[model samples]
Target: MSVTGERLKALREARGWTQEEVARRLNVSRAAVGHWERGKNEPSYDTLIRLARLYNTSTAYLIGETDDPSPLSAAQGRKRPRSVPPAGWGRLTDRQKEYVRRVTDEMREIMVKELLDGEQ
Candidate 1:
């Protein structure tokens, strides 16, 4: 239960909404929303539910229980995780997927470093 102020602020910022906007949606005052993001106060149970719905997230995520707030958790008749890719990569073997993942990871690291260094 990582109820950090920064996490709340991050979630709010990800939606590109102002504190007043969130407040209006949650039917609360802007000051109340500000307080929640500032770690000065916590929302009530009903308010928490409202916030979760408004943010399209789980209450656990809002309180920082898990990083994945995908609505799939509550979804019924959900499909199992598929090891085989959908179409293009479906023909590849497991070893091939591993190779692809390794190469992609390496490329991602290189690109991230280059961007951080301000290089083209």
Candidate 2:
């Protein structure tokens, strides 16, 4: 099975949930969950996002893109390399750099929106 399938099964088992229970929570059929666990199929991006949220994990972790289970939200204030690595940015991978960039962008957007709203 794929890493995603393995992780999904492990997460479900860890929660002591039956396939039916997981399916119910995900608003999918039991067979769909089974398929996901068996690596017969993968969830759509939205469904994957839902799964990550439901499991309290990150989409990257669920998809085997990263081993970190903590979601991006967990790093809500970690938009800078200085925050992520007090030492420096040299330790960051390309993927981590990209993640920092994305977080910074999101934070900037939110700050702009809030500032504009306060002006009203």
Candidate 3:
């Protein structure tokens, strides 16, 4: 079987989720999930990224580029300079905005820690 298919199946099975459950999270049909796992088809780049997020893994891992599931460090992860109130941030409700802020802050902290750890 394809590496991508293997990883997808392994990750989903490891989470004890059925194809239907994964489909629900991906907003796709169960057949889509089955097709992906069976290597009958591949997800688009956008869907691959979404899958990585849903599985709490790195796109690299999903695509068989790496064994590590941890997301890229901030430097590698950031595709562009971060802007305050990033596009669409204003569209979120106040509570959602706060949640985004908290998550962003936590991610920053984790990035810093990773950087420090690498230096040691």
- Report lDDT per candidate: 0.62, 0.74, 0.74
Candidate 2: worst-modelled 10 consecutive residues by lDDT: 78-87
Q: Model 1 misses residue 102 by how many Å?
A: 43
Candidate that would win on TM-score: 2
Worst 10-residue lDDT window, candidate 1: 71-80
Candidate 2 whole-model C-alpha lDDT, 0 to 1: 0.74
For residues 12-90, write the lDDT of model 1, one tens digit per residue: 8998989988888878899988888887876765676577668776654565434666632422333323464434456
**lDDT for predicted candidate 3 compared with the true structure:** 0.74
Backbone clashes in model 2, listed as residue pairs: none
Model 2, 1-120: lDDT tens per residue?
A: 866799999999999999999999988999999999998987765677789889998765776655677766533643444355423347665855575455445546755786678789
Ranking under lDDT, best-scoring first? 3, 2, 1
